[model samples]
Target chain A: MTFATRFRKSIEYQVVEELSRSVRWDANRIVVNTDAERLAGVCEALAKAGGIFDSAVLSSPASTRVPQVCYAFRMPDLGLGVSVFARGKNITCLSTRLDAAAWDERKIKDLAGVQLDGLEDARPLLAHPESGWGDFAEAVSKNRQTVLKPSEAYASREYAMEGTGADGEFEIPVGPVHAGIIEPGHFRFFVGGEDIHRMETRMFYLHRGLERQAVGRHVQRILPLIEQVSGDESVANAVAFAQAVEDLEGIRVPERAESLRLVLLELERIYSHLADLGGMATDVGFYASSSQFLLLREEMMRQNAALSGDRFLRGVVSIGGVDRNATQENLDATADALASFSKAFDELESMTLSSSTFLDRVFTTGKVSAFVADELALVGPVARASGKSCDLRRHFPYGAYKKRAVCESMAASGDVLARFNVKANEVKESARLIRSEINQMPSGPTHTGEKRTGHGFGWGWCEAPRGSCSIFVRTDKGRISRLSIRTASFRNWRGLERAVNGNIIPDFPLINKSFNLSYAGTDL
Target chain B: MHELSALLRAPRTDEISEEATDPAIRKVAALLRRRSGGVFSRSIHVRMVDAGSSNDVEVEEGLMNAPQVDCERFGIHFVASPRHADVLLVSGPVTLNMRRALEKTYAAMAEPRAVVAAGDGACTGGLFKHSYAVYKSGRVDEVVPVSVHVPGNPPSPYDLVAGILQAGLALDKKEAAKSGKS
Candidate 1:
């Protein structure tokens, strides 16, 4: 028996008596249904049984069914991820036990109108003063044309910065409208004598009701909309969304298509990392290094445009297949571009590393302890920098990753410098993987294997430049029933609060840039 | 010679012409020539607001400062506050959450200020206007009247520069229209 099967069999044989009567595998997803009364015991048993908490999935009530809320778990050792679901209007709060589930459960409260019985924080997740309660059903419903807007401000408008009870603490507020060419997000720092006691981040200023807009849309038509969830992560989000739809319909992607997807994903990682690396240098006043990095980044983008029609690599990905032909000629040109990039990048990396000024600023700045990272369940480079061995490409191989091994770059020191080192090493690994995949990729017709009529649910993920991005897609007929996008930024954004504690106010920008969490992705 | 050097030495195919080529750009170029008589503004100060874009325009705006397409060399500079700006660059479809913020930024700007809607989202709300979290249409013009529109899913760096230059051209009309109204 496979590990997941063995684990299930052991539970059946009384290894875990509470969950034995409740669990069964729906294909690869282990579905556990238990009464609300027995839910806590089952969850505690499952966690002891090596289940890592992912996110909680929420769905509004259908005419016949009650509102359902599900908590997803990943069995790291067994290569299996499952969701424990319960149907109710008021579900028990999983965050009370799992710290990682707080943000998601809070969002579920706002979106589906499902209250968590024991949840501590009662703030709105996506509802704004102007867009109060979102009229969420019409926003995501199939029959709906224009999304519903709230008439008048229906709820509390301001974000209350809950005090840490520190005496003489004053607040320093920064942008939803910032200084540079960046997105809007408000950060309120509760400080006493420049020592930040606590920082509260207010996002959703960029929340455009992505879930509501996507719910009733056909799976095939949502690719462009998916790309917009986070611009820098366009290709990564597209691949995840496409793979989920493919999984829902049981379509098999061609090897050539898989290889092409890998190349594009790696290229996206390179450019995204370059921007971050350059921004780090710029933040530290090393303008020359920043310029070099941006020049290099510009070259990569030019090459992206040459390969794909759009610079952001939009319009190239479609459900079940890619839109553009990733012919041998296109792949060869990309190889040549990457070959040049590697040499230029090597020199830049050495120059940046050797700079003592840069190192002094980044080292020991914004340290996230391994313990805290674990508690928050951080993913991506942020988690890996703190020595969390959880790259999705390595852990749960899908698409091209299943065909070949991914050698991940990790760092033990959870600081800005460590995050920088992790990204620098990853860029090289991605480039190496791209070259190897291209050399061995088989030649074949790029499109095949899709059935559009039937429906089911499946999850897809890939390691984005910053971290692992996962998409959960449940389909009803041909349209999406529910879509939950969990970006690496979403998990790590929470970790930012803990990371920045005790660091000076000025170092905040450097550390923030290092994490580079997406406001759009997180808010969505 | 190193391949990196050759790549760096490459003539960029995406630069805006010193002499105008596109008809809209020609109009701007002509006005700008008269404004300084061939001498560009010491700095065409710009302040940007992300109204509701997918951030493609911001990516392009950030790229405009890169060595090849450096907007600073041409005397166009991004400023810290709207109070010092001669032009406003807005991206995204204006979300309901950001409508007041965008308007406040525009109101803070000095007279002769021109607004350039930088992406498809900012121009016509792109794909997100109808979404509930966004303003009714999400167009920058709906919130703050736009002087120029650079429409792409995101317009390229050069296209953004041309649009900014067009906003530079529109500055003269703000004066003319002001006098005309009086």
Candidate 2:
């Protein structure tokens, strides 16, 4: 049976029938006006009936008559999406039932001052100790520039970690300022001798208030800002933001533009995967193969710089379509570069997998069994490596992805080796996809030749190198009213904590590099 | 490994131009590279701090350690601690969350320490300056004094090398000031 039919068969529309709510606007959005108490039951029923939590966004009173919160969910098998709007000064927390809602609810509670009644942890999500969460709530609600005194407000928070209670357990505090060029995040590990008993992550050191800064800006003006959300996934986030805006205005992107965008996304996926693989190799102390991977990455980046002015492929994706069209010469150059990259990449892959030391380190180290991954709703390679078929491209295929089906890579072991295998296989898949898209390249304008000055609420998602970078944009007139971006990294971080529970403290960096979650993406 | 050796010996079509390198900078860099175990300590240990970047700069920084750029050949090596660093390479605008961390890190650096502020964001705060959650200015100079400015959205790998070279000049100036000779 089809998923929608299955969903309908599973549960009657009893929740809505019981509430007697009027369905007001969109085909997917079920508009239910009910008390906070009734709304919780309605959500519980829908979630029980198979609503995968997408993201939760709480808007200021300006967006609604009262302070409002929307819990977004999508059922991939059915290709259906719905938003549950619960309007109140204090909204009910879906996290009571949904494990995935904890992070989103915590963020809402901290940023909007909406008390989540059953929240287990009351610790601030973004604010430092002395900054006072109240000032932040006021500033974000006011949506204006506010001063946070650097001396007092920006103090490093002292995170309290309960003792593991095992007689020999002790903590190893790793960084807000780390070695190398990676972003700042503090990780606390409690270990008894060599084995880690527990771990906690303290981030927001790289939090630059991306959502708060995006308010009241023209859609076109914020493309560059959105591109910086995560540099490697720049094209992916921009495409998601653009698709969300385009869907809002009911605009259609031309065929050629769509094809070009697909190529960009795939190209980005290739480079992003390479960095992770290279990182894994480095962590394993296999510098020779790591250096080779880096060389390959540099070549692809040079090609990106040639096709577009920016190497990360930023500044090219626009709201309507794209900023630049690919010339035949550029396409041919890219194809040739990627062709070489594939050949060399295969050799490097074999070299990496054949190395016994590398295998010994990554084989069963930091394995996240299928059950743990499923419980956390981890996306991207972390989930894929667990042998879970959670590919968004296969399930809710959008844009040019609807035309060409992508075969996602998955491994059953759910270890660092499995992640490596998945990433390497994905690199090959992306390279093949790029070649096919270029050959089937549609001929038309790169952009729709339309400038937008109107707005609506729309959702867009593109499979980033990491995984699904799902975005929701709400606009009024031309300015952005609310933007809720849930990057794969944001959802996947919890999986890291679970994955590292039984691993050694020394292997933490290796396990971390395996997942390679973006600190900035998660913080944003 | 044989294939890797062959690939290394093979000619590269996309050869990065030497013109991007300045003779004076190379002269100093060569001096540093040759002065190993000397009082000059030609090998400069760098510690990098990312304030509020998109991680694009980090990618480029990683590439610098790759076979192509291989920054260690020029006596510039990235160290793990600020205490051991002779130079500090920083990327991104100064975010409020990172302000104290950056300041404390800078303070922890030993004397003769030179800071190279990499990327347009680090140089001038770029697109992130006005955000409420960020330090209003966002520039590296707003928190810690910068010796050289590397400008680009996220400056190219070559631009970063040049900026690091300029930081060599800054180290000398810092030394001169310390000796009451400037």
Candidate 3:
């Protein structure tokens, strides 16, 4: 038996005895149904039994079904996922015990209007006060016909930010509109002179009600919407959503399509990391190396445009498989481009490493200790740089990643330089993976042509360029009833708050660039 | 001696030939120059405001600053504050949460300022038109008077440059109108 199967078989009796008698399997996931009151107890038991918190999703009430909350966990040793289901409007909060579930719980409370007893932070997460449409769940239930309050009423609504209140500490409020070419997010820093005492981040200015928009749409129609979650993470998010629909319907994607998907995903990783590296260089005033890195990044974007039609690689992934096939000529061209890119990239890396100015700025700056990384449940390069082995591709392999071995690049210091090194090494690894996948390109139809009719829920995940992106989908007769997305940016934003605690004021931009979390993805 | 030798060995700069310019950008650049009596052809400060985009538009704006495009050569510079700008480059389908910020940014700009909506979402709210969170189809024009609309899913760097240049022409018209009024 496979490892997941063995683990499921081993856990079946225990789940029945402790949690619920309705224990069953949904692919590699172990689903256990329990009462709302026992939700906290069951989650605590799972944690004690070596289950790491992954995500929590809330599905609002409908005519046919009551409100439900599903908490997912990952068993790293066995590569299995466990989802506990609880049905009720009022549920016990998991954040009181688990720090990682704090934002997830807050988001659930905000979007669904679900009441969580003993929730630590009761403030709104996505529903900003200035957003004329207040109480999203109420608006959804009313079919969006609720009268919007006057702008002036919300004009006075403000978010609360508490400072340390030290002898000379003062608060500095930065943007929802930043100085650079970046997305909007507000940061409040409590500083004593130049040193930061604490920092609070306020985001969701880009919230466009994506999850509510996906309701009642066909599963195939939502891929384009998912692509807009983040511009740079288009392919990874699309793949995660497609895989969720595929899992729900039990459709087997073609081997050729899987291989192509792998190629597209790794290409995305390379371009995304190049931007981070270039951004770090730019923030440190190393313009020579920064410009070179940006030049390489632009070349990669052109390569993406040549391979797929769009420069951002949108409209390429579909429900059952990829929308278009890569011709042999295109594959050959990509391999050739990657070879030259490798040489240029190596030279730039050495140049950056040898620069004492760049080294002085990056080393020991914005350090996120391994303890903080684990406590916050950070993912992607941010976590890996802090010596946490939480790569989703290696832990929960899917598609072509199942057959291939992905070498996880790691650093223990968790500083800006560590993040830079981690991202650089990941770019090299991604290039290697793409070249190999192109060489052994499979030959077959790129789609399965399976009927899209299903009445169940399933989970899909992919290790995006930034970190793990997970999607939860529920379908009813080929139409999506509900969907939830937990992006790496959403999980790592809190980690950025912790990372910027002790750093100085001017180094804020560099530290922010090192994390480079996506505001659009998190807001969505 | 080593530094002098390295400086001497640096590559020579080449003149930008007519063939090197994108035709779309050249057309807008010529229009802007002719309309402004060659004044704006030397300098046009731009301030960008992201109302609520998926960040594709911002990425394109960054690429416009890259070496391949190098918008500064065309006298299109992105400034830090709106008070220093000659035009506002805004992208969105304006979310209600960002509507006030967008309005504030537009209000912050000086007179003779022009606005360019830089993406399909900013022009017509693209895919998120009907959502309740966004204000009135997410169009930049809903919140501000737009001089130009560069409509793509997210416009390419060359298209963005053309749109900014078009906005520069609008700025010249605004200045003329103001002068006439005075």
Candidate 4:
């Protein structure tokens, strides 16, 4: 059977004939707005047809009293997401049917005050109840929805969980204060001796409210903030944001710009993955391999800094094209650096593999079953490590990915070691892609000043170092009215929760570091 | 003792090998011995405040398991309270929510304290320069007297360590000037 036919049959979506009364608008993607009642039926049909819910965002309309909850769905092989907007009098939650919509519903309930009547676990997702949900209420009202009262913010959700368990089942609350030099994230594990019973993760410590702040401001001005969403994945976020804006304006980026974007994106991915490799080594106490990778990462960062003014590759990508262009000298220097760095990276990988201490800790530890990975809808190297072949670059190509085929990396075991292997493999692939992209730079105007109107809906997806970052831009006239960005972190945080189950508390750092999902990305 | 000194001087990548006799490692060994002479005794108590920047949350929690910039290894202790602190670690572009938090933390600190602003967001609001939520258009120095600027998107732990050491050196200079006056 054909992949498409098999996929369609796997998820049973009723192929409905287009009704004459249905209002359809085609711009960036196909859009058909149906009443809230029809939305559930469509979702069921789409689910039956193997269309997965990519992301769902709920925001109360500024002028209307009724809430507007949007569900974004993607059919894997098709590379398309159809957003269904559901509105009603205190609408019923889709989380009941689709397990993925659970968190989305909680976020809606927290910010827009949308009461999802049948939500299974309607815990306050973004706000602290002790501080009062005032900023959340004010956010919905003022259209300034990002910044909430300090007491009721995303960071306040973490604290020591209180409870007693069976004999020898003592609770170990590890962080939101860690021992290493990494981002802040708290984990509470209910442990019996060495084995874990239940583990809960608390991320979002570095929420900058970039989403709330971006509203009302010119979309062009907000690209830099998007780049800073997480310091490491700046290029990916910038490209994703630019692609979204470009799609909305119905403009095609120049060929040279696209090639340069791909090159920079690959370079960015190289440095990011290098750090992850080094971090994984560090976690296993392999200082020799760790330091080697660290020094390599530092060298790459310096090269990147020379190519782009910012060390983190921030503020270089604009809405239409990149802010700066790489000269031939710059491309040549990067090519030369990658050639030598690849040798060093290979040696580091071998040294790490040979190290008994490193392998012992990561091999069978933090095993996330393929079944659980699919259930949680994991992405990036984490899911790839487990034999689930999901790469946004392969599935839905945007930017240079459409032209140049991506070398998708995967490992069968969803353990720390598998994640390490996937990341190591990706480093080589990213370098190969970067060298090719740099070699084939086309000459043309770097940017197109296409007018942005708040008239339609646009969506963009890019494979960030962590995973796939999807952006949905909803425009009012030519300016953005609403934007919902689901970073790689948002989709993959649940996998960490599952990966930690049955593992000892100390092994958490190694497992978490392997994933390296951005706290800022998820929080925002 | 001199033999131990000679051993320290060997150039090494993996570890300080007994038989290795490289010139570069020899030079490093000499440097280490000279520096290690005094037991590296010093501690600087620091009280960190987010200083109203978006960075307030991170500073309040002490930068996720990042080793407390232990100058005491070179000799320094990061104090929890301002009354005992000799240095103030401030992170922010200086936001409206954190303006009062900054002043209160600074006011509570004991005298002869040095302030080190530790991020691009804190050093200069970076991209968040024109927001209404921000109080100052520039660095933390504009609002609070800053002695050191450790700049990065978020500076590495080593950069942070280097900044704190710079602050300690500045403290020594201030102490010398005070003693000279006395």
DockQ of each: 0.49, 0.62, 0.53, 0.11
**TM-scores of all models?**
0.92, 0.94, 0.95, 0.81
* Best-fitting candidate, scored by DockQ: 2
Task: Report the lDDT tens digits of candidate 3 across residue range A125-216.
Answer: 87776555555667654436222566543555667889988888999999988888888899999999999999999998988878777888
Pairs in clash, predicted candidate 3: B92-B122, B93-B138, B94-B138
lDDT of 1 at B21: 57
Write model 3 residue lDDT over B58-121, tens digit each, in one string: 8889887777667887788989898998888888878877888888988998887889999999
Name the candidate, 2 or 3, with the larger TM-score value.
3
> Candidate 2: which pairs clash?
none
Q: What lDDT does candidate 2 reach at residue A261? A: 91
Report the Cα lDDT for candidate 3.
Answer: 0.85
Q: lDDT tens string, model 2, B92-144?
A: 78777787788889999988888889888888888777776677678888778
In the range A1-524, model 4's lDDT, one tens digit per residue, is 87545644552532422311243434334344555555656665666666766777753233456767677777775666767776765766666777766776677676667667778876666543432335554554464422435564334443445434667788877644344333445577888888778787765444344565565667777786777666677788888888887887777888878888888888888988877787888877876677567667767766887888755666678878877888899889989999998987787787788878899999988888898776766778888999988888888888778898888999998899999999999999999998888778788877776655546566777889898888877666555566677887888888888888888877988888899877767766
Give the alpha carbon lDDT tens digit for every residue of B46-147 in model 1: 999997777777888999898877777657899999999999999978877777788889999988788999989888887776776777777888878888
Cα lDDT tens digits, model 4, B35-73, are 332322156666665533332224222322222222234
| Candidate that would win on TM-score | 3
Cα error of candidate 3 at position A25, Å = 3.3
| Stronger candidate by lDDT (1 vs 4) | 1
RMSD of 2: 3.0
Model 3's CAPRI class is medium
